[model samples]
Target: MSNIPPAGMSAAEWQTRQELAACYRLAWHFRFTDLIYTHITARVPGEDGHFLINPYGLSWDEITASSLVKIDVDGNKVADSDYSVNPAGFTIHSAIHRTSHDAAWIMHTHTRAGVAVSSLEAGLLPLNQIALQFHGRIAYHDYEGIALDLGERERIVASLGDKPVLVLRNHGLLTTGATAASMFNTMFYMERACEIQVATLSMGQPLRKVPADVADHVATQYQSSMGEEDDVLLEWAAHLRLLEKIAPDYRD
Candidate 1:
């Protein structure tokens, strides 16, 4: 058993498509979607400069293994299909994928909690234990209109700077990982962290902040717990089981 499994395994393209489709279905199940607007993308297994994205205009729940669009880093479709991708949605993803191969999977969302946290001047405060897990690990990128410009990719990449999570300030949340399981786990926790932050702030009272050194220590503990065979995949497998029962058609 390998300590660190391959990122996006160089397995069959069908398997990659299946997991990518599962990512969409799980996002929909978890309400991480913005209609057909936001995107979740993955690097095509064994291929360079090509990726998979949900087709334009299909709600996240409607995404399927065969419906995902294969596109270049530039977001242009590379094969014949009934679907096409939203260029603007790919704008953020392409920047990271083009620059960081370690980020084989990326997720972006506009959930109310996520946006509320991002809109805060002090973003994603360490309000609790879960929130503390991200103390020194996340980055922020200022929202630049609607991510339609190619040149903004550079700045977005700079903001990311090898981090796995990026709060698109004044916009929403983003998470990256070498695998869909890892990325989705990050997205799930990141969203929950924002939800906790929002719930705490709504009280509108004096808040007790975690001492900075204690926060850093807890974050270090989290980082140490994750890399050994990635127990997050166990949670991801449980998610896949739930999806199988409720939305088996996603594997179509």
Candidate 2:
């Protein structure tokens, strides 16, 4: 792959590609990736209905800024590239992006703990502080086998509604944000929450739930903290610095 930016691409689109690439590297750092499967997509700035996604065969760690593929909402390539997009995975992502304006960035993961929690009947429990952020704000979409069917698109949109997170029953986890930083932040905390839940359940003891009112209060506090600024920007910058130390080529 070439490190040079594609010719004629707008600076804004190039920057979005870089950020989306950083998100993939960060996901790998957090161990939220499942081999070459799953996807992280971001809306190309200034380009309506166009988005950036990883090339089909690359693992999260292998994805680079210039290697990302630009695709329209229909999963068709909007720009030339040597790589192809995964239509099956793009089904879920395209559906959400087309249906919701707030879904500027979407992330899906098949981590062990995320899938484990999705299999549970109760879904995500409000058993800890991190989990509380999702209280009453998360949506659950039932599994309907592999998501290759285009018909499942409407249902995926309906299941997601106006929520930021979706727990794919018997499947895995999905999160979205208006920016890549916010979406990455959501996935990081959510994946950690799932890991904690799984570890807690393994002790085979009853788990204490945070009171409903308190959980709601905490969730409210988190929402209020966002106000006008993207609260995750600073943290995302820190992540970029860390990535520079470990995998600087992702920015290529």
Backbone clashes, each candidate: 0, 0
Give a tens-digit lDDT track for model 2, residues 180-210: 8889988999999999999999999988999
Which tens-of-lDDT digit does each residue in 1-252 have in candidate 1?
112223543445678888899999999988888998998999887789899999999999998887888899987788777887787878999998888999999999999999999998889898799888788889999878988999999999999997889999999999999888889989999999999888888899999999999998889888887544458878888998998899888877
- What's the lDDT for candidate 2? 0.89
lDDT of each: 0.87, 0.89
- Say which candidate scores most in lDDT: 2
Give model 1's TM-score versus the native structure: 0.94
Worst 10 residues of 2 by lDDT: 222-231
Instruction: Single out the weakest 10-residue window by summed lDDT for candidate 1.
Output: 1-10
Off by over 4 Å in 1: 1-11, 226-228
Error of 1 at 245 (Å): 0.4
Report residue 50 deviation for candidate 1 (angstroms).
Answer: 0.2
